[model samples]
Target: MKKIILSISFIFTFVICFAAIVADLTGTWKGLIKFGDQKLELTYKLKAEGEKLTGSIVSSYGEIPLTDGKIAGSDFSYKIDIGGGPQESKGKFMGDSIQITSTFGGNSVTNTFKRVAEK
Candidate 1:
């Protein structure tokens, strides 16, 4: 009986931790990507509701609404259409930072984003 109780407690703790990890993704994150010799800054304003994620990717060009966003544990994925085509990005949410890999035209680039503190 004691073993069973301990196991149940462990499972409950794991479930709560898993949920909180995903929930922590909400807020602003900033990163930079380089195109040849030029570097462009990217900002993400993310909101997570359960497994559904909604956000906007802002840059000097303009703000692009994120689509088809999903989150599970510390992993997330989202899509953006920039007229040329729909670009999909997959990332892992690390504490205080996130690493994202985006593919376009048969090329992939990975960028690391740091979480921005709210004012």
Candidate 2:
């Protein structure tokens, strides 16, 4: 009985920690991507409400709507369709930094983004 109670408590603690890790990703993050000599600026806006998550991405070209977005534990995946061409991205949510892998034209880039400060 005592062992079972301890196991339940441990499970509860793990669940809370998992939720908190994903919740920390609720904000804007900015970073730069370098391709040899060219550097591009990237921005991500993520919002979480209850168990639902939504967000968008803005770059120099334009804004892309993130669809079918969901977060589980500290992992997240989202989809974006650019003019009918579909793309999928997955990333790990860190406390202060987020690393996402995205593919374009058969090329993929993984970027690290730091959380933007709220002003």
**lDDT tens digits, residue span 1-119, model 2:** 99999999999999888778767989999999888899989899998754556899999999987888888777888889998577998888878899999887888999999998999
The sequence of per-residue lDDT tens digits that candidate 1 reaches over residues 1-119 is 99999999999999999889878999999999998899999999999999999999999999999999999889999999989878999999998999999998889999999999999
Candidate 1 lDDT at 108 equals: 97
* TM-score per candidate, chains pooled: 0.93, 0.86
> Listing every candidate in turn, what is its Cα RMSD in Å to the true structure after a full C-alpha superposition?
1.2, 1.9
lDDT of 2: 0.87
Worst 10 residues of 2 by lDDT: 47-56
Worst 10 residues of 1 by lDDT: 15-24
Top candidate (TM-score): 1
Which stretches of model 2 miss by more than 4 angstroms? 49-52
